[model samples]
Target: MTNAGAEGEPPLDAESLAFLNRPGLTRLWAAARTRLERGGLQPTGTIRLQNLDAQEREALSLLLARPVTGPTATIRLPDLDIRLRASAVGRGLAATLAELGPPLTDRRAARNAAQAERIRLWSAAETTLAATPLAGQPWARPWLEEIRRGGTLTRQPSGTALTTVTQAIDTLATLFPGTTPGPAPATWGRGELATRTTGSAHGLDDGTLLARLVLRGIAAARGADVPTDAPGRRALWRRASVIPDEVSSTVLTYGLRPRGGTWGEKTLRERADRALETHLTLRELRTLRLNMPPGTRVHVCENPRVVEAAADAGCTAPLVCTSGSATTVVLTLLDALATAGCAFAYHGDFDWTGIALANRIMERYRAEPWRMTAADYEYLATRAELHGTPSLPLAGPQVAAVWDAELAPIMEAFGVALHEECALEPLLGDLE
Candidate 1:
């Protein structure tokens, strides 16, 4: 019989096979493993083994039943198969290698897997960044750098969930008053804004994951605090005219009397202890038709406490509290007042967020900066420093103060926060 006659005999036992695959011929084994993983073992195929040692050459000589020439040898798979069947007591070369050790992964396959993973992460990040309104603004670069450092706004791991976040941000960004004064910021019903921006009304509803990502980004861009509750989120959205859940998003005012309504007039007359805490909704503001006497100065405050104090002092200051960020209703009233040639004097907390709000208010309503100046901040900061109360650290993102350019530097130097309440006594004195 030929040397290949033993077809029914069992292959070498596991222990002998293990010794055969030990460190000596590791390079040859690795080459065979790659070939097997890429394109399964077959007769008439060739594989090259490099840097062969004496032990490896001997192993190869025994396996192939032929002498190897040198350090490198291109072994024919068919020849190895015949040799393995005849001498190694195996059916084929594949069966012999299987008895030797575990299978190895192809290097090319591993590289492709890694490349695909990188693509997925970048695709999600790029999509979200491009959709944010700040994408074209100065803050976009730093914000993107923050994201690239693995500060993901959404905890979602799936591509579909991240894409949903991107869509929501796009919807909200489109609502922020566009630069260069195009069409008025699209103030639609909450549902309408979602549908127009993303193709579904429920896409940006409150309590959703997408909603949280969008809200956080909005607060970041505006240098405002990250809202914690439903009311807080609504206030943030309203500030941008995004109007998420518009019906519930209302602006609180103490003394806002427009010429159209007898009630508005009545509210203005019944000032003092009977302050009108009018809460105007999105729908009401959109359809609102009110006018004020020309050159009227409407005093705007950031806090309800200031407005409440103004009302209690019986100051008759024509005060309007933005409550937090100016909601759609506040903006609507201010816009109407501006149309009738009313001037606005806005005051807010003396901090980064406050300065940002002051800038936005003055720019939008052509309002003058009221007690929101370098002098104002410096006076408050100096008093606090002298009294051993250094004020809270200047937190939130840095924003430039166009109204008083030096105000930003003074705030940075002092690292103090002067809230509207801190200067409440002086503000009330001004009202009188």
Candidate 2:
């Protein structure tokens, strides 16, 4: 292996170093050093210089004491060693170059050492995985492959990648907390897990290596592409029953009068009486005494504007609006409502992505269509056309509207997207 040279070696005298560092002779010495490192310390083979400018040719001629006339110059390794030993450098080319530039390195030896280390690290990793619940699982293979191919472990700041591998695997095992097969266990918060596992509450913060590593395993097990956006990442964490950010990730509501006296419930009641929208954070959802009381109707929309418009119109009914992509917290609230036997009706934009979101929401929450039908889309598009409003081309991958099969085909044929804001009138009318 090559080492950093200057630390242990005695400094070469300035005059001996100056000869190798001359401006015109710089490239010549570099080529010579490259040959030594790749070929090993003992000088052999030849160094070739191509496209020599006037200054380099003059310097070469001066050093060799022979008139050099070609565009290319070649120096035999043994000949140069003998030449340098006889010069003021007073050492062979290996020692001379070592003194002048970075230390001499054996490229082949370094490569062999690196390959051996990688094998050792991966073996150690497999052994560690074997000790966990993930042992012998098919999904574990993908997790192992992801880290190995992505160099996740090797990129660690210290030898801690292995130690981190252990910590991360242990943390991941506990992620699917209810796997014990009975009444499901209570879900864990990120801070609680981080504090217990890492001795620091912030240890699993987003973008932290530990969080990213754990997420890779989750993605691998799900056979899904690793999520790149915050919403996608947080959604993956939620699958393991981890609430990423209870206080920040929230569901927006208007006119929800859950009878619970808890702060979250009371806030909703107050906001509704005053005809205002309330943002219900995931943290509050845990403490709320009332959430979609049995037989109550719950309306879900894709945009916040519909909720705001409902509040403005003094429509006092249970309404939830997923501000954009329905987040983990939004799903949490919906899960709570579903458990309480609330009826669900969902609506979103008529775009491809919106249809996809609607599919998940309706299927998971058993929601009926809330003016989110093909007829609704056709009406909106025709109205816009009459008003001279251009239809925006649908973007993103096509998603089947499982709730209404005809919806996607019509949207595809129309080749335009109609957002919920365009349908605000009827949605608000329904709430009223």
Candidate 3:
């Protein structure tokens, strides 16, 4: 035979054999090889392998029958020493491909079961509560807020719960006299108690209790002989007939009264209470000047003493005093004025807190910030001797975006707090 080779002999060229046997090329190819057997076919533009050597390329060619069109491809090696193709080779890949596993199915089933249970519980609770008397009452607002804030009537100390429940029972008894006292548990769960209490106390289902309370309130208002126990429905109806449409009309008229009148002294007080109750409008002074017939000039003060001092000085301007934290009266008055299309010019302390309060009043009632600008602060800075040292750097959560941005900065710069009453002389002069 020629020197070509013996039977079944391997390739004998040293360089060629060494090149074919190069570990770097094999290692690189092995590392770069993305085993996408468990994954879907790669998208068209994805890079499949990086840093290919000549031998690796030849090996890949011999293995692959067709050109690789994507990041991953299947290959069949018939003649090479190695046989490799994209196949589910291990438990991991097989598990993924078959899409079956007890753990996964169990987890999903558990989650679904939990959701179903929650829905069942919520529905049951809602159904039970819907039949009660307290349904759709305003008491739910604060109760809901308390619940959101992690309050529980049950968790309340026995003394407190007893007190509250006693009051509720007394109120209910007054409304539903001769009605059997329902099972009142000492410590019911929050949702359970809310549902039960609302239904029983508010008379939402029968409304006999509600009718009784209404009659009692009306009788009490009119100085009539009222029953201590639940008043008869017919008696309530008779009393209700006096006002005819009292429920809707009374609330609507009460709400509208503040915004309707000529900001008179008595009317101002009524509106002040309403605004305070509704809007929480607080101010130091409220001044009303009488310039024209039925004239309405009202000034609000942050300090009661300022109003008192103004009055002492024989200042005829009608005033309302906020006292602090704008009581219900102050807000009601403000709302009344606002409803009547009366424009308000507000002044407050020059400190950060005052700025915040002034901005709040302005925002809530659409009142104008009178002399609450940086310019105003700057002018006031010249008049008042800074005292009490700048308060611990204010925790400024929100600032009026519309007013001068410089206002906050100037307060920070001046490092002083000035109350509205301190600058009252100037503000009062402006009214003139």
Point out where model 3 deviates above 4 Å. Answer: 1-151, 157-163, 178-297, 316-318, 385-402
lDDT of each residue in 59-119, candidate 2, tens digit only = 8887666777889998888988887778775677887777676678989787777777778
Which TM-score value belongs to model 2? Answer: 0.57
> Which is the leading candidate under TM-score?
2
Candidate 3 backbone overlaps, count: 38
Query: Against the true structure, candidate 2 has what lDDT?
Result: 0.78
Better of 1 and 3 by lDDT: 1
Candidates ranked, most accurate by lDDT first: 2, 1, 3
Candidate 3, residue 259: how far the Cα is off, in Å: 14
Clashes of each: 0, 0, 38
C-alpha positional error of residue 137 in candidate 2 after TM-score superposition, expressed in Å: 2.1
Model 3, range 248-271, lDDT digits (tens) per residue?
A: 111011111223335444454464
Per residue, candidate 1 scores C-alpha lDDT tens digits across 1-432 of 012222355657565566556676677666666676665344446888788888888877766667886988898777767766675455565665655654444556766775565566656666675755546655444544554455453345546545664665475456554532122345666678777766888867887766666666666667778788655777887766665665666776656556655654555445433654566676666566557666667888999898777767767557778876965667766776688787888899988888888888989987888888888889988988889874688898778888888888888888888888878888888776
Candidate number of the best lDDT: 2
Order of all candidates by TM-score, from best down to worst?
Answer: 2, 1, 3
